[model samples]
Target: MTYRRAAIPALIGGLLLAALLWWAGSSADALRLPGSVGTLGPDAVAELQRWVAPWAYDPPSFLDAGVQGHGYVLLGDDGRDRYNGIYTAGLQIRYGAVFAAFVLGALLLIRRLPPVRGRTTAAFLALWAWGAAAGTLAAAVSAPWFIAAAGHGSHRFLPQLASVTAAGRQLPVAVSLVAAGATVLVARIAAEGASTPPRTEVPARAARLAATAGTAVIALSVVVLSYQPVAAALQAYSPDGGLLAEPGDLLRQWLLLGAWDAPAAGAVVDWLLHRASDVLLLAVVWWALSRLPGLLTRVTLPAMAAGAVGATVLGLLASQLLRIAVVQTGPQQGLLYSSAAIGNGIPAALTCGLLAGVVATAVLRLSLRGAPEPAA
Candidate 1:
């Protein structure tokens, strides 16, 4: 492999990760927002709020959504000071370790899968595994960090102690149902792929294409992640402030995309649109890798190139699901779950997914080399 081979991925992942941590760690409140204008403001609240929304869960009991969202945030002045501690060093290491684990774990899962069909079959399993693994990594890293950073990394203090409101309780069943629906969908997909056979090598052409694609993933992820600081500044300085504040309303303001804007309702729309953008981006990565064809000798490269697009979609969607599902409240902020919103989680998902997709394709390419040829 060329010296550029190693440098490409390492540089991308490293730089992207650094910028995100810097932004989140810079100000405690930046990671988490106190709240909106509320009918009433807590004298103890870090920032005054004329309005407040309940957490995802119904409140009345302190542990519910209402309190967690506002309690710590409204915890007066000393609360803010205590929230600003620097266990960030430890959290940084934790995030890195989990991400590395996901990448390596995915490769290991591929090595262990039974047998499968053509370039696409092997590629699909690999894509799914890589995506699930990447998402799992982000969840593992961020979830714990969120839980800990609020309370000296302890079990009893952080999210548990803060109080909440009762709005979330209006339909507790509905909230659980949404969460359950998402989990079931994710689990069903994972289980289906888990039953797939082990694949040992990808086709020669597929392998080459995957390598180039993987290289591209590293490059693309780096560029996008690096620009996060710019995105953050934009969201921060804006009037409504933050992407989710009124995404439908905010999106209308983004007439910058020319003809590509069609936003929907609610916070979930943000998820749907963000993932859609991610898929679009993955398509671009697909285009980038596809353009390198003909120079590489592998006949199978074309199919694998197409598969790269699928891999990109899977890589990103999986991460988005996890980052969103996991409870990610912060000290000064309500929920710092997404990187695009707060930490580098969104970028992490995008890049990590891309990396996994390329790796999966690469692995499929390796397997294709040894498998019997498909019918002409």
Candidate 2:
């Protein structure tokens, strides 16, 4: 099928799937696995209540029916059974729709673009520019909704999100666009070399080297950029923000913190250790993505997309596990519990990550399905 014809149907299908997943995730709280700390005992219940207080009119109550009501009961801000407002649901819809469009658009653009001859400087510049434009468009379309959501309860749950939400929103879109564009561009370049009459070892090796370097740069840059939020989160534990060490310090803590060495050190170490699970969770995603067949075909898209969703759920569980660990580990005699920080930060990260992952996965899968196979 022509790229456009295939892409349009795929986009529509993705949007539908995204909407379905969003509704199910938000309404059903599918990410809140049973036997999770939040659904366990009295202290856990209270903690869950406090966590939900900002968003819900009433804190979630554990329902032990072992059937339809066998989990935490969510009440909306209006005291309704559901947790989200009309505006909240609308926000999710917009997020899902825009994400699907951006992913599909990038895929379609990549498929439609002329094949690249080699690692031309012009090609790199053009791809970067296109990525920037796509990211800008996505931010423009989605930022208003996110900003609006920010005021509702996001700020309460994730202190300072309003300040950096725009950047956070833009970065993912930009990265996704750049990744998709570069993948296609590099694939085409490789194809060109393969199709040529004379296959020179040097040129092919150069192309492979360049591709590896570019991918590494992009991946490392993203990881570095992500560290800021992690650092900020770790800093929240300190009242005067004294534990507000450099990103390097936080990274060190994340990598090294094993046992409570000292009071101050233990606090930072514990916090970092908690947040570091996200890295492991992300690794799970990378592992799943890697397991996808090397061929860039439509058949594997659904599985990859499902893996994304599954990874998200796993990440949310990881966050909950962090919370459970904190409570179970008990308070260090000399250390103070930064309830404000933990209460505010973890829930925000969990909620946003869960929602964003669902939207991104749905869109990415649809985009992949819509994209045509690379020419042999």
Off by over 4 Å in 1: 1-4, 24-90, 98-136, 142-376
Determine the backbone clash count of candidate 1. Answer: 40
Candidate 1: 10-residue stretch with minimal lDDT: 49-58
Model 1, global lDDT: 0.35
TM-score of each: 0.28, 0.32
* Candidate 1 residue-wise lDDT at 273: 54
For model 2, the run of ten residues with the poorest summed lDDT:
62-71
Could you give candidate 1's per-residue lDDT for residues 43-160 as a string of tens digits? 4232211111111111122222212322343444454433433224334554465345433433332222212233333433433433333333443444443444344334333122
Residue 244 in candidate 1, Cα distance off native in Å: 34
User: lDDT of model 2 at residue 124?
Assistant: 32
Stretches off by above 4 angstroms in model 2 are: 29-96, 99-143, 149-204, 222-376
Q: Give the alpha-carbon lDDT of every model.
A: 0.35, 0.35
Query: What lDDT does candidate 2 reach at residue 100?
Result: 60
